[model samples]
Target: MPETAVADTATGVPLKELAARHGLASSGRLLGPVEYARQLWGYRHFITAHAKAKTVSTLGTTNLGTLWQVLTPAINALVYYIIFGVIIGTGANTTNFVPYLCIGVFVFGFTQATVSQGVNSITGNLGLIRALHFPRASLPLSAALVEIRNFITAMGVLLIIVLITGEPVNLQWLLILPAMVLQAMFNMGMAMGGARLGSKMRDIKQLIPFIMRFWMYASAVLYPVTRFTDHLHGWKLHLVEANPMLVFVELYRHSLMENVTLAGSPRLLWTEAVIWAVVVCGAGFLYFWRGEKGYGRG
Candidate 1:
């Protein structure tokens, strides 16, 4: 009888109760975690197809095409070799310094590309986000996939370069598979977090490059991780060794290069890498999901 008591006129039922009974929800309602993950799984095929399409189209406009993927990192390694390896003499005592540096650059580039693209995944696809009704996580995921594809191409070239630099194709090289899988997991987490931040704060997209550059330097992409251990000791040494990107780079180097010393013990490096991947991937997914309802809104 109250003025606020709205009902389904014909059925004489409260409107809210009727909607619930019919399994209806607000347009922007947040899904429960289980249901959300289920929906995401349903779109797995779509995600892969979308990723493949983007991978091909991303470099389609360029004359060099996908060659740019390998060339970009290859060229970066060359420059770093000139500055650090030659000019600074960081490579003075290191064996296969060219291959070591290339491994670092190419491996770090995978994370850099994924996170950088993830930062724009949502903001860059505003129109698509507004027009479509799909799991928003797909954007960052697809972006990560694009980089994964590029990284694979770049990796082939990397192995060739390593061999050209006189590193043997030994049993340890097989370890790159697990190392890359861990790195990919970590990169995906970073991408999702970047997507959420970029969606909410557009300015983050501009700052990500500088952040990634700093990360690259800290990851020891140009120099050996020993550079950190040589200067810092105790907790400082431990802290630098804990860097996930550095962990991944060292993992690849250990697998590919002979007689390379890691910043930390092998067990410690692997343990930290596994921890980083699990924690970041879980946390990033939850963080992005929590903001789902707010996406595409002012």
Candidate 2:
């Protein structure tokens, strides 16, 4: 028998053996969580490029392009402020509510868009999933990344709005950074879980918008969470206060606005936010990864 051929390149792996080594797993193989994570890491560049491409392609056909990212949320914040803050008097006791509503709408929309897009990631990319031999998680991760980019752009406008509405820039505002990180993690988890769920039940895509709408209201995006706690008690009050989106909204509001109190204490909210981010992200990733083999099946 011929001696074992050595790989001639610096990586020391031949094109055939290399493929054979990596080809150890078939497409949609059920990888261990750690192995799945490593696989995803190896595809980081693809994830980033795909995410940026998706974000651009989404608005590329339009003249305004990325400006819409900033405008859409601004308009929503204004509409909510007008409808609930003015007509309904939801802003009755809240100070600096223009900025408050702005923060809530922008922050909540971040997670909301992630979940909505996540619900379609795998289904929308069925062609790519079936054709390409990459990690299935990339689709949802890319969607979450798109939302993260959009959120950053939207925040630029949000900060300007906050300043225009007379919220002072203080050390507390620095808290926005950590809160954003946590929320991003939370969004990633939601995206992962939604992708798995949506891929299985295509009808779920249709229902997500309504679910997010309900989530928005429950998050106190348009009104104060106090509305829930002022009368309700027991599990009801806890449920309202414990809503993850509400926690994120309150965190953003606390960091951005002055004289506004959170639904829960700052300490409680921070602790809960961390837990939500870790638990949801970890669970969502594993859940989505576990469904890898099933994503592209007929």
Report the Cα RMSD per candidate.
Answer: 2.3, 5.2
lDDT of 2 at 93: 87
Candidate 2 residue lDDT tens string, 1-298: 8877768487887656876877664443478999989989999999999998997889999999999999999999989988999999998988877888888899988988999999999989989987988999999999999999999999999999999888889999899999999999999999999999998898998898899999898898887777887878999899789889999999999898887878989999999999999999999999998888888889
Clashing pairs in 1: none
List the candidates' TM-scores in order.
Answer: 0.92, 0.91
Error of 1 at 245 (Å): 0.7
Highest-scoring model, TM-score: 1
RMSD (CA, Å), candidate 2 to true, equals 5.2
| CA deviation > 4 Å runs, candidate 1 | 1-25
Q: Looking at candidate 2, what is the lDDT of residue 199? A: 87
Candidate with best lDDT: 2
Task: Return the lDDT, model 1, position 254.
Answer: 85
Question: Model 1 lDDT vs. the true structure?
Answer: 0.88
Candidate 2 residue 291 Cα shift, in angstroms, is 0.7
1-298 per-residue lDDT for model 1 (tens digits)? 6588789889999988998999998786899877887988899888899888886788888998888988998898889889999999887878778998899989999999999999998888888888989999988888998898889888999999999988889899898999988988898899999999999898988898899999999998888777886799998888887889999898898899988978777788889989999999878888889998777877
Worst 10 residues of 1 by lDDT: 221-230
lDDT per model, in order? Answer: 0.88, 0.90
